[model samples]
Target: MNKENREVVRPDGTTIHYTVTGPADGPVMALVHGWGCDRRDFDAITGFLPRHLRVLAVDLAEHGDSRSTRDVWTMEEFARDVAAVLEAESVGSCVVIGHSLGGAVAVETGRLLPGVVTRIVALDALHYLSLFPAQDECAADALLHPFREDFAGAMRGMVEAGSPPGTDPALVDAYIEKMSAVRQPAGLSALEGLVSWDMDAALRETTQPIVVFAVRAIITQEAIDRYGDRVRIETIELGSHHFHVESPEATAALLAAEMSA
Candidate 1:
C-alpha cells in the first residue's frame, strides 16, 4: 500500500508529521518510533504486513520531519502528539505499537485515548534504564551527565553505544541519517525528560492487552517478571539495544500477528 503524509496541528501549535500505509478498510495499527528516530524506522517491518492491516507510522514532534516549537519536551507532550495524529485521521480505535522511547509514549496514548486503543505492543522497552535506582549522588550524576557534554559528540557517542554489534553498515547508515538530523538542544532536552519519567505505574494500570518485547540488553528478567500477565514479555535475541533494524521482518510479523489476535 502507498503511504500518505499528513500534517497534524497540535493544540500547542506544533506541526506533527504522520504517514498512513496499507488498505483503508482494514484494522488500523499505529506505530510510534523511539527517540531521535522517524516514522521510516519501521520500513523494514511495514512492507511485509498483510493487506488487511492499515499502518499509521508517525514522526514524533522534533524527531523526524515533524516540527517542534517547545523549548523543552516531556513524555506528556509526546503522548499528546500521538493523540493529535489519531484525531487528525479520525481514528476511533487501533492497535498501538511503539519502540524504545515510543513505548512510553504509547502507554500514555492508551491512557489518553481511553477505549480507542485496545491493544499495545511495546518493543524492547519496559522500564527506563536511566531511572533505575541508584545508590548515591555520584551514580545519579554519572547517568545524568552522560550527554551533558558537546551535543554532536553526544549524538555520535549514542550511535556507537546503542547500536547492535555486527550491525549491517547500510542499517547503521540509515539509523545515523534519522538520528543525526535531530537538533542538538532539542534532542538533549528530550533525553533529559525521558530519563526522568517513570512509566511503571502507567503500565500497571493499563487494562488493554499489552505485550512488551524485552530487549536482552539493558532490561532485566526481574523487571519482566514483575510485569507478569498484565504484560506479556518476549525477547528478540538477534539484536542488542536497537533490534528493530536487525529484525524488522520478525518485529513486523509479530506486530501483525498480535493485531490480528
Candidate 2:
C-alpha cells in the first residue's frame, strides 16, 4: 500500500521522520518503536485494523530514518518530536501505542500534550530500569560500562544470559542485526540517557487513560498488583522483551478497541 511520508522539524531544529497509512478521516493512532528499532519495525505485523483509524508510525531521532543532531538526547526531546508530528499532521486527539523506550516517550507525550492524547497503549514495557527506580536495586552501573573491543561478545553474552528462555530465533536475529548497525558510543549514550532519567514523576503527572501491555513473566506479580487498575497489564505469552514483534496483531487489536471506546 502507498504510504505518505514527511519530516517534522523539532523546536531545536532536529528532524523526525514519520509515515502515515490508512485513511485520512480515520481515527489517529501513533505507533512509536522501542529502543534500537525504527519505524519500519511496525510493518508486516498488523492483521486487522479499524477502517476509520489512521496509523502514524514515527522513527524517533537517531534511531531510524530520523535525523540525529548534536544535542543531548532525552525523553523530553523525544516527546517534543512526538508533539511536532502530531501537530504537523493535524492530529487533534490520538491513541498512542509505544513499545519499550517508546512507551516512556508515549507517557511523556500524553503528559505534555494533555487532551490531545485520548489514550495510551504501551507494549511490553512496565518500568524501564534506567528510567524507573527499583526499591532495593543497587546503584551499580553494571549495565552501562563502556563497550570493549570484544563488544560483539558482550552483546552475545547479554542475549544468552539476560534474555528470557525460549525467545523466538527470528526476534534474536533482528535485535542483533539492528544493534550491530549502531556505533558503540551512540548505543552507550542512548542507554545512559535512558537509565539516568527519573520518569516516575512524569508517569504520575499523566492523567490520560493508560493501557500497559506487558509480557506476563517479565513483570513481577507485585508490580502488576500495584498498577493493574489504571494500567491494564496484558500478557504476550510467546515473546520475550520484544513482545510487540511476537504479537503485533493482538496489540493492534487492543488499540483498535481502545480507539472505538
Candidate 3:
C-alpha cells in the first residue's frame, strides 16, 4: 500500500496533518493517536491492515506536523480536527479508533458525526478510573497541580504509570523524552483538557458501540464493572497502555476483526 501524506485546512484555519493508505474507495478507518503522540504511532498497525481498508492516521492539532493557532483545546475541538479530514476526503462512513486520549476524541467524533461514524475502538483507553471518571473541580485541580508545577516531572510520572513490570527502562525513558517535548503550552493545555474532561457526559452523548481493548496490568476491575454494561471491555495482556505500539500486529488484527464485523 502506498502511504500518502496530506493536510486539511479546518474552518478555524488550522492545518490538520494525516496519512492515508490502501485503496481510496475502500472502507474508511480513521486512527487517532493519544496525547503527545502522532499518527506515526499507527504506521506499523496500518501496514498490517487488509489492503481493502482505507486508513487515515491523523495528527491532532499541535501534535506531530499538524499546526493550529486555535485557543480551544477540548476533546470536542480535537474531534473536529479529525472530522475535517474525513470531510475533506468525503468519507461516507468510518470506524474511529483512538488510543488513550484519542479514545476520548473518538467518542466525541461519534457524537459529532452520528451518521458518519459506525463504531468506536479504544486501545488501552477509557478504562483508567482516575482519569476517566468525572472529577470534581477541586479534585481535578489537585490532579493537575503536579503537571502545572513541573511538566517534565509529571510527564515522566505518566510514562512510569503506564509502564508495567518488565517494561524496558529505555522504552519508558524514550516515551518520557518524546512526550515531554510536546510543543510548549499546547502540551500542558492538552493535558489539562484531558484530565478535566467529563467522560461520563461524553459516554452519555455518544450512542455508538464502543469496544475498549484495555491493558490487563493497568486496567482496574472497578472500571470494567462500571463501563462493561455500557461498552464492550476486552482486556489484553500483550502490552502496556501503549500496547498498539508494543504489539502492532495483534492490535491491527483486533481492529481488522472489528472493522470486518
**What are the models' TM-scores?**
0.87, 0.87, 0.98
> Which consecutive 10 residues in model 1 have the weakest lDDT in total?
127-136
Model 3 lDDT, residue 22, Cα: 88
RMSD in order of candidates: 2.7, 2.8, 1.0
Question: What is the TM-score ranking, best to worst?
Answer: 3, 1, 2
**Model 3, stretches more than 4 Å misplaced?**
none
Local distance difference test, each candidate: 0.76, 0.72, 0.91
Q: List, residue by residue over 1-261, the lDDT tens digit for candidate 3.
A: 899999998866589999999898999999999999999999999989999999999999999999988888988899999999999999999999999999999999999999999999999999987776667788788878998899899989999999999887888888899998899678888877887788888898888999999988998889988999889999898877788988899999999999998
Kindly state the number of residue pairs that clash in model 2. Answer: 4
- Cα RMSD (Å) between model 1 and the true structure? 2.7
Scored by lDDT, the top model is 3
Tens-digit lDDT track of model 1 for 76-113: 68988899888877888898888888887888789878
Cα displacement (Å) at residue 246, model 1: 2.6
Steric collisions counted per model? 0, 4, 0
